[model samples]
Target: MILETSVVPRDSAEPCADRLVLGEHVLGVADGATKKPWDTGPDGAELAEAVAGHLAATAAGCPAREAVDGATALVRGLLGDAGVGSAVSFCVLHLGRREIWRVGEGRVLLDGLPVPPRPSGERIVAEARALVLRRHLADDVPEATLRADDPGRAAVQELLRALVGLRNRPDPRYGYGALDGQDVPDLFVEVVPVPGGVREVVITTDGYPEPAPTLAEAERLLAQRLARDPLMLDPPETKGKRPAANSFDDRAYLRVAL
Candidate 1:
């Protein structure tokens, strides 16, 4: 049974980089990294759609490895040997194996418990941003002004870009995962078998700081966060508040019943 699913662009002006795919025997969520101005190839939204299409096309009983291999090849084909093919993070469910294959930092919950991954270096950068955000706010900077033009951006953009080099490095300090049509070390891909007792699974993008059990609840939690700390200065600190969007990041949530 399907509970709910949605993918919305941050603002009406831009395309959403997140995607949700439901295949015959599998379904998953894909989140393409936001593109930067220096980015030269197809936008992350297009890449995400391509990857999502590949995921939804997989035949029933296809091995999770083969599915990912195909997606990786597609990404490489699209971006070629570019210096950085910003990739997509995903969480896929293989009904045949009763397994969930997750790459990167997308969130997942079985029953009501979280299936957490190791911390990445994103926090370091998020804190840097929060520091700037708070300082500006203390100086009476309007929240709307911060959203329109992030004064804190220049101070931390370089630090944020540096994290790109750490992708998939397997380093405890900075390594994170993604599917960019390259060889993602096994260390970054997590294949989890759904226990027999587990009856439901929730998969979501990091847009929601804390994923709730239901879509209504998820939206509620997101609204609560946006109202209380739009800057995301608490735990899962992000780059900044919504740049001109409904939420800070594009989001997708999928709940399934076995």
Candidate 2:
């Protein structure tokens, strides 16, 4: 039984980059990345929708890993060179074997504990922001105006790009993986086994601040957190925009049970 499933967008104007697919025996969730406004190609939401749809269409007969590979290939084919190179975090729940396969940042929670530890990129991103912030401070730029619209935004973005590129190499310590419109050799795939008697499992994107036993509780907690720290600036990790911008990333939550 599925207790509850939902995909919520951050704002009305922006497309919801998150997707949820429920097949006869397979369930999936995908979280799309946020692309820059200047990027004219397919956005993260489009990539996520296509990927999730392909996975659901073939999941009944295909193996989980194969389904993901196939979906990636199909999406690449469809986009071709015109692809914007956006990526998504995908999670699939196989009911037949009580197993889950997660790629990128989508999370699997069993009994309220994360199956695999969160990515180390969070700390890296925070550190990178601190470094960028220091550079901007030397230029006498205010922290509030450090978004894409600001004049100094380009320089800041350049610094972030260089730092992130250096850190995003294919290595255990820094290889942050995602389904970015390219072949990734160091894909982070986690296979988790469900507990013997556990009745339900929750898979979600990183939008939720933490895992909760129930989807409602998780949403409530996430909302509270967002209200208190909309920009996530307290610890800030490559998020937040100028005032009047969407405060949170796209969110998806799914609960499947026996």
Candidate 3:
């Protein structure tokens, strides 16, 4: 199930935030931008869509980590083709009937405890930047380039650092940088299998808490509503509270049971 609402001011190319839920798994993607000029391009949103499409199709059969890896690859491919640069954040959940993995920063509500926040700073900036740069060289990488070690992943890390220095400058056509200066967030998550019972899995973007104090508060608020009215999971009131469109920030959240 996929539920999304775009806060208008649609004169720009950017869409609010978008989300996708497949089976017992959920995914959210948010695009961040700097306030300087306002280049609301389609790059971040497009990469997120690709991530959703790949995850929705392959997650059911593949390991959650593998699913995330493939989806990340897909995003890299899309951004490279467009010669676009932007930040990305994602969440992946499996029913816990099986193993699951989550990487990158975002909110994760397991049982009830909110995991301690992941490191979010220049590290995120380096990671998101590298993920985009890797796409350009993926095809040329030798299958044996790093048999014992994945050079591709390593290369991405290094390149990300180099790209971060190339700060956003004013362009008559493109505007300010999509990712101002704050680093993107990332998470690496996996749910340990419980014997057998119904379970609720929630994943959300950082935007949901931009105004709130912390992710724990947002998750608790959303979870309380879900416990009482599962249908309230997707409500128009939710959209109204989301960041205004053209802010170049997008967010998504999902809930699932197994």
Best by lDDT: 1
Assess every candidate by TM-score: 0.93, 0.81, 0.48
Candidate lDDT scores, in order, read: 0.79, 0.67, 0.41
TM-score of 2: 0.81
In candidate 1, position 166 carries an lDDT of: 77
Task: Give model 1's clash tally.
Answer: 1
lDDT of 1: 0.79
lDDT of 1 at 148: 77
Q: Give candidate 1's TM-score.
A: 0.93
Of 1 and 3, the candidate ranking higher by lDDT: 1
**lDDT tens digits, residue span 19-120, model 3:** 453544434333332211222344455555555566656544566545545554555455453224554445555542344344444555544445433443
- What C-alpha lDDT, on a 0 to 100 scale, does residue 228 get in candidate 3? 45
User: For candidate 1, lDDT tens digit of each residue in 1-258?
Assistant: 787887766667878899997887777789988876556677778888999888988887777778777888888889885337577888888777898888887888899789886688878878888888889999999888887777666667777677767776778768877777676667777899999999888888887678877888988998888888776777636555665677788888899988
Q: Kindly list the per-residue Cα lDDT of model 2 for residues 143-247, writing each as its tens digit.
A: 566553433334346544543343324667655655654454434556677777877788888766575778889888876776776545555546654455554
Error of 3 at 179 (Å): 15
- Mark the regions of model 2 whose C-alpha exceeds 4 Å error after superposition: 37-40, 82-84, 117-122, 130-156, 159-169
lDDT of candidate 2? Answer: 0.67
CA RMSD, predictions in order: 1.7, 3.7, 16.9
- Best-to-worst ranking by TM-score: 1, 2, 3
Show the colliding residue pairs in model 1.
72-181
